[model samples]
Target: MSDRHMICPPKHVAIIMDGNGRWAKARGLPRSMGHRKGVEAVRETVRAAGDLGISYLTLYAFSSENWSRPEAEVNDLMGLLKAFIRRDLAELHRENVRIRIIGDRTNLRGDIMPLLLEAEETTRNNTGITLLIAFNYGARDEMVRAMRRLAAEVAAGTMSPDDITPARVSASLDTSGIPDPDLILRTSGEERLSNFLLWQAAYSELMFLPELWPDFTRETLIHAIERFQRRERRFGGVTAPSLAVGS
Candidate 1:
């Protein structure tokens, strides 16, 4: 591919890893197998993002709505999460990747909380690309939580309703301190956000690819980066005069 996009790589790239079940169904395999394969894709994508110089890579691993899935599948997912951290945490740490978990952690499974904390604590000081895992996360819930915090503050006389600016609201969310994603991608040809990063994705370049999560590779990521580089992010404003159509 072209080296031009490499010169100006996006600082953050977020992905909604979709179509694991469909992928498995297409091959007449158990859905669990698709999730396992998706984990492999996660590993490769993490490594690739670092190599590509992307500063932050946020992955939508589990959504709050995922709780409604079958008990067996939920258990399988929990097991896979535990296994991934146990098996890959050290290598991720060694590579200087900083692990950050977003979403509501207050109600996570009994055995899962410690592992997630360990992953974050272990990599807290790393200076490399931040790998954010969006587990049990929903954008609307994030907003509600943030709003409650502000409302409480206002009611308690700490601040007025006027203090509820966009910046304050943003800082109160789970992704506080992290910049918004430059590109939001979903595989399986899905065009919707599915409640992923609604607030943060306001100006992101949306990309939908036909590949399932299990089929994602470094090359796929590179192509997404190239696509992002080609976008004209006006951010609700006009472009600079130098590039005007009739200039």
Candidate 2:
């Protein structure tokens, strides 16, 4: 039998790429150096995901809380982000991957926001793997923003407050059109969601790895997929096959 027969693949795989700064510190290099190298890992993982037939890949690129870092480090990260978007847009388009940015972007630098919008516009219609970059994102903030918007409509009498539900909140989120993640992977051995995707990860299978984001290779990603395959995601039920029979 083939790997496909034994492994259950996730249609949407979300990753929290952590430990760039720590990785760099361990190497006696600047944190920005780690981020720059992490971009290479991003490229490799994207290719691997496409080859593995994974449809959606959401990466936690930057969080709103990250802004609290030193000004120089924050600027450097933003610079790296801008460079990645500009350098990788054409290649990503060539791979037929649709690029999307999900976050509270109102406070982003004007220059970077325009480039991000341009990148999204250029690859909006591609039909391959969807690469969602969560920049300046915080799950709590996302929910609050959605609630505020809905509350405004309800107060205006344009929408009924009683009609609001999880579906409505989901639709109001930045990731409205995308499906919830089936599996969530966090590297660098961290074992927390860290406000990545609150509502969207209600039933996601999670895997934590010790490898830092800069050191993540295609092999590492493939191994994660392989591990994900071994899990029996019951999703609160007992429909999975019996392990004794499969073994």
Candidate 3:
């Protein structure tokens, strides 16, 4: 496929930015250093997606289970996040990219929460591309939290339990208005989902790369996009139209 054309261009792309700690350890560097470098990769990937005409890009920045790491490391990661947003948010806005943070806000520090909100509000009107950061997120947790809210509303008679459905639950999710991922990429050769977006990735094409998060580049993204374009998405039922002969 050429840079101007692809076989299966995904409108939404989600990525699991993994292997930062391992990448750092291999180089005898602090984990924070790996995270700092990972930010550069984020910038590269976002620019590549925008250039490829992708409408939505989601990054698994932090997971709910990540709290199990050392307190110092967690603090450092949070600091890196704050710095990334503060420094890059303006440039991203100028590029017409909308920023949105998804995950459990209750676990975030009050001070950090405000910064996240500000980032989202700052680029809410942009129409070019959306950058979704999955911080302190877990797909299972999101589903559970949505269900709990629905249950509470039903208990209070403000909503009916019978009215609860997939659409309602989806609307309650942090990514309510956004479409589910069409392509999912994981770096560091990891094959697991890691509870990133279990429900949203039902039909997404999965691609695993051996490169660490910080090592990803525009070329890597282009290769992945090209590979994705070659696949035929049947979405269950009959075969793809491309496979139909004599049509």
By TM-score rank, best first, the candidates go: 1, 2, 3
Best by lDDT: 1
Give, for candidate 1, the lowest lDDT window spanning 10 residues.
1-10
Q: Which candidate leads the pack in TM-score?
A: 1
Off by over 4 Å in 3: 1-8, 240-247
Question: Candidate 3, after superposition: displacement of residue 205 in Å?
Answer: 1.0
Instruction: Select the stronger candidate by lDDT from 2 and 3.
Output: 3
Model 3 C-alpha lDDT per residue in residues 60-116, reported as the tens digit of each score: 988999999999998998888889889988999999999999999985774788998
lDDT of 1 at 30: 100
Off by over 4 Å in 2: 1-8, 240-247
Alpha-carbon RMSD, candidate 2: 3.9
**TM-score for each predicted model, relative to the true structure:** 0.95, 0.91, 0.91
How accurate locally, in lDDT, is each candidate? 0.94, 0.89, 0.89
Per-residue alpha-carbon lDDT of model 2 for 30-126, expressed as tens digits? 8888898898899888887887778899999889999999999889888888998888899999989998999998967759889889989999999
Instruction: Name the lDDT of candidate 1.
Output: 0.94
Candidate numbers, best lDDT first, in rank order: 1, 3, 2
Clashes of each: 0, 0, 1
